[model samples]
Target: MELLFVFLGGAIFGTIARYTLPHRDEHGSVLVPAIGAVVASVVWVALTWLGWAWDGGWIWWVSLGASVIAVVVADLAIGRHRVQTDAALLTKLTGSTATATAH
Candidate 1:
């Protein structure tokens, strides 16, 4: 019963993470769910290590909520970094091409 609850919590967290990070690309959709699963596992482990007991039903809910939030936050931070890196790459590429063409 406890294992079932934990699995359900992880699934809900995964779904929430997917919904929070809306992606038009199918590739992103698949990746986000897997990322969410990892986030859920991390949260579960952390909570367990921190002496959090799962005797209460609310523990599952709390863990799931925290996991979802963590996933969303991580996705946003990483996405911003990726965008900046991509922009830099494009700028460098354009500059190199222009310089080459000038020669």
Candidate 2:
């Protein structure tokens, strides 16, 4: 179905967004692409429900565009959150004795 194509396109860009980002290794590969595909699918469905035909160009564009944007933002947020978590964990494990100036 045409929705498949939209999802596929979003996946491609999502994969690109993930692989192209720094520290991508910190996260799972499937997560980013999965997010992209799902977002695209939902967007496409929403547009269709709102009267955009299946073959409409705007539907395709908006769906794919939002998916890519969401993927990138989500990827970045995950990476940053992981980094912060690691830092917090390290601090906790090291105990309060190790302050910022301890380095």
Question: Please, what is the whole-model Cα lDDT of each candidate in the order they appear?
Answer: 0.63, 0.89
Q: After superposition, how far is residue 85 of candidate 2 from its true place, in Å?
A: 0.7
The regions of model 2 sitting more than 4 angstroms off are: 96-103
Model 2: weakest 10-residue lDDT segment is: 94-103
The 10 consecutive residues of candidate 1 with the worst lDDT sum are: 22-31
Expressed as tens digits, the lDDT of each residue in 11-94 for candidate 1 is 666666666564323236545555666666666667777887868655666767766776677667667777777767876987
Measured by TM-score, the strongest candidate is 2
Model 1 residue runs over 4 Å out of place are: 1-8, 19-27, 49-51, 96-103
Residue 56 alpha-carbon offset, candidate 2, angstroms = 1.5
